[model samples]
Target chain A: MSDSVVLSLAEADSLAREVLEAWGLAPDHAAAVAATMVAGERDGCTSHGLYRLLVATASVEKGVVNPAAVPEVSEPAPALVRVDGKGGFAQLPFSKGLPLLVEKAKAKGIAAMALNNSVHFAALWPEVEALAAEGLVALAFTPNHAWVAPAGGTKPVFGTNPLAFAWPRPGREPFVFDFATTVIARGDIELHRRAGKPVPEDWGYDAQGNPTTDAKSVLDGAMRTFGGHKGSALAAMIELIAGPLIGDMTSAQSIAVDAGRGGSPLGGELIIAIDPAGFLGDRVDEYLAHGETMFAAIEGQGARLPGTRRLAARRESLAKGLAIPAAFHAEILDLLQKGKDHVPNPPQGSRAGSNGAGDGSGGH
Target chain B: MSDSVVLSLAEADSLAREVLEAWGLAPDHAAAVAATMVAGERDGCTSHGLYRLLVATASVEKGVVNPAAVPEVSEPAPALVRVDGKGGFAQLPFSKGLPLLVEKAKAKGIAAMALNNSVHFAALWPEVEALAAEGLVALAFTPNHAWVAPAGGTKPVFGTNPLAFAWPRPGREPFVFDFATTVIARGDIELHRRAGKPVPEDWGYDAQGNPTTDAKSVLDGAMRTFGGHKGSALAAMIELIAGPLIGDMTSAQSIAVDAGRGGSPLGGELIIAIDPAGFLGDRVDEYLAHGETMFAAIEGQGARLPGTRRLAARRESLAKGLAIPAAFHAEILDLLQKGKDHVPNPPQGSRAGSNGAGDGSGGH
Candidate 1:
């Protein structure tokens, strides 16, 4: 009745690990990276789910990713931790540094982790949610390829930079939300292109600095930021905080480094963690309850919190398994077969430009 | 030609100090608050400038505020500074905590200051600009009265919820922005109401949950957030971080305590400072230069950065002095002549509701 082919969580996990491993990823790196794919699938984020397997095949071509490189972690100061991803995917470095970050946050009341020179490979929610699971508040940011323009300008200057925040709640699911500052994700433009539909006017501008609904021109031109100047300011903040502050690439620099390889974006990531207990001491629960009241007030009026839908989908996906498109499953399988040899050539006719296709396919 | 009266910066400062001192504020409190008022005037933020002195007089009426309470500062953790405002305005506590926060950030790489039970009196830009002036990156947030609604609902569950961020520049003025998450400000609606003008469609919703242009109806209903759902999420984050995270009141709780007394909102403020050297170390200059490249890209496109207009106004104001409205100046002079007794009544019909005229008048 449908194009969907459901995959159990175990099957999904194994499928991701196997494809990544066949491309010469080390067991440690493959497992950490595979978790992102399975988590995405389980959470109903089709953009970042097993669909990224095909995107990975295109990115993992020879000499691009250091599939075997090990991430290094160090605490350069009392409340700051540094992670050198060594040109590998960010997952391993994040996994390696998380415990130390949590520990330092508990010790100092506030802590930050600078993950530098890493290839971004997943959504930020998982990372921040992990901190919330440890009963800490968390914020994370990273610069992507230069796919968006600054406010009031037509040129592509800022990244579709993403910002994520998580807050811990007692005896319930932690509230989490991760979204791009861009009006729409680049993947959506590709979707419109494939479907032969025009995008919304607010989404992007044409090469002549005019608003355009034609998906192709928007892809060729520049995407606009959400909320206009306010969003532009946030994008700039993300670029500075996650880029230079962590000693990594800005969006423009990132694309220049990318240069038509269809690889994952290379840059830095910043994670800040705060321990409420440090400020509230024994009164933590009292204030957390106050947060619940605000939550109730929002829901009482039929308003949903940012991650409400994701959580609902998560529960459904957990119970009934993931429903991925059958065609995508075949593409992933085809990628699994051909990618075993790890061909260096870019995917045939799939990528549009240096910053094209899966450039935004993996992260939501 | 214009109905404006020029006031030298020194004269403006003295006028503010004398008015507040006459209202029974301690000399220290008066001086600290006077600086914010003058800075706003210098930077062309007329909302938070000397006009706030009028708002303050209304809020400071009766025994609601502690005219002479010294803030107490404590370091409960290595990276946390706590300031008990003791029913006083936030300015004094922020000033009291700034040095300790700077020391902690330098020593530990990151530090946070929590000011609890304080009354907000100015825009957040000055606090963050001060930190950037000290060579540290800073972020600040505080909840105003609950005058704004969440993304999809009509009831006002969230405050205007202003967020401010500042990054230190090597030699140039720091990149600073302080703004509410609302689409427009509550004060703008009042301005529209007085002029009998229809507000923009995106500004607010009426009591029936339909977008309305009637400023009075919108004010009676609720204002909308800046970027729809994304901005709503930010407002929620601000409420948690600045509210519950600091063991203070939520906007709803704050208003409940205020009881429509026409006073400044009562709550907590959270300020986080990050030492760039902690992350970049000796390579700090190299990375800061990387940030400059991004700034050049933005400016080269002829797109101005946030706070750009304010900085330009600051220079002109310094050279030419501030031009206050002649009528407003006369009113202040009259209040100054008769306010020596520190009357306790809330200022006439100039005040509106619990979250009335000046609720958003002092912060941009």
Candidate 2:
């Protein structure tokens, strides 16, 4: 307790919403972006939290994230949809697309969407969890720029491409698991950089193609694949699926195209949503219940679920007040409170969708 | 080379093909199975090579795998299909289904198939590699009977649930990667059992829910997840996608059903295939080239692509007569040369698809 601060979930969400709004994102997208960020924080994923606001806002300012653009279906099939994110925020397309997939999968059992040209918003848990809430299982994959080395090879050939999965449990925590295929995510490396700490030797190779413990080299070199070639292979596969198949720019090419332009740093995303009930029939309930019983058994001692620790942290914060390091808070207040004059926002009277909430698909 | 045994690839394929034919599998299927199995042996993956033949034959004899059944597409979409294996050997369905996916994806950019009721064969890499050769990237997920523990659960709740990915590279080995999400595949347990060895404590759980080193307990209880809960979450996700979605038997229920019937052991599988050239235009070559360059750095001195070693071994074996272990050769001969009442086959009249040939798909 001595080392913690708390904020009510409501307050944190409100602040997150306000921050996005201030950055000129449409109100609905703002809410999603905010909620996702807060959810990450609540779920204990600080790296993907509010700290990303500045970068996201900067991308929007650069015209890479079109807050007003709407995601459109580029191709349609029973089992898959190709979505053009239209330079909109990644969350918008994912939010809109997931529901559509759920709908179709309910009829057809399973459906997938290939998302192109969207920015990375935050951790993938929020979207998957949201889908799980609708009684559908969901999984998503996204590939960032080439930042990881293939096993035995050096040079950033692949991104920290990550995979996220969520399954509904009967009456327990919705099972959620998300992770980067790389040995270390770029954010983790950044954390190490900020702390002036050395990274694990196994995590990366230096620009010289030699294994090294230096964190800074990761910026210029490559993160090692997780578990050597196994991880490298997985990352490569993820890139293939989430990158080109989604019809998005991939690997070093995307970065080169965006060079100096400071475009939206969003990578490509591929998501699949499945309606378990379609195939499991009445057994869905029993299946999920069994999952919960088993999960609870595993939670026996002092361990926690993949995202539960974050939820617990979030609860504590909500019960108290959100903890913002004094410096970070001061920095936020300075930029947000005083920089309002410099920020550009959409003209005031544009209706924010029907419920005064923006639909998840459309941009600014 | 002291620890290595070199066998000519052609000789290996021929011998394996001979043994499989003796097992009552068609010649074509035998060729494909032999190819996959020997490929693993060639690539240094002894664990998945010749060792799998016995189990496969057992499954066939037990009437779990129909050597003659044809794999058929029950439902088809531009980007997806549902495959009914008709209790055929898993290799046949996978081999057939993979190419169908590749062809459809090439025509439409992406394709996926859910395979139901198939028996296990060899590793999933050969199929992935074939897809890569077809200039398509491939991902395959297979959920078997539960043998791995959930995070906190004492008993097993998932099978090893192997996942694999392969991407075509411009001037190097296709980026093939395959792994079991569990700390160990059940095959490893069987190996330990044969060797009368104890497994590492971290690999499995005891009946009371604590980690144990006894492989026997692991067999009796459950294998531990690869990285604990993270692995469990992944396994759960794979199960949802590969098992229930495929309209095949799933989890404990499926195993229980099999046990009750006293039949062949089998599970469902999900395969997702993407044609990179279908979407990347000229960018595909560049992306692959960049991947190679990146990996070239990591290749440092002696690093190899995930599947390259095996492919190399296959090449070498093809050049030289394959050398089979005296023990395995003896075993195969004993079965093939069984003393009496053996029906000699009219080679030319063998079932058309039964030879186990044609690019490892095992399509009947």
Best by lDDT: 1
lDDT value, residue A286 of candidate 1: 77
**Model 2's CAPRI class?**
incorrect
**Tens-place lDDT digits, model 2, residues A213-306:** 8888876788877655556667766766676555554555555545555454454677777676654555666555545544554576444667
Can you list the residue pairs that collide in candidate 1?
none
- For candidate 2, write residues B34-104 as lDDT tens digits: 87887777776777787667666655555556666677764433456665666666777777776567766
- Which window of ten consecutive residues has the lowest lDDT sum in model 1 chain A? A355-364
Per-model root-mean-square deviation over C-alphas: 5.6, 7.6
lDDT of 1 by residue, A151-243 (tens): 988888888999999999999889999989999989999999999999999999888878999998998889999998999999999999888
The residue-level lDDT of candidate 1 at A166 comes to 97
Q: Which 10 consecutive residues of model 1 chain B have the lowest summed lDDT?
A: B355-364
Give candidate 1's whole-model lDDT. 0.83
What is residue B292's positional error in candidate 1, in angstroms? 1.6
Best by TM-score: 1
DockQ score for candidate 1: 0.53
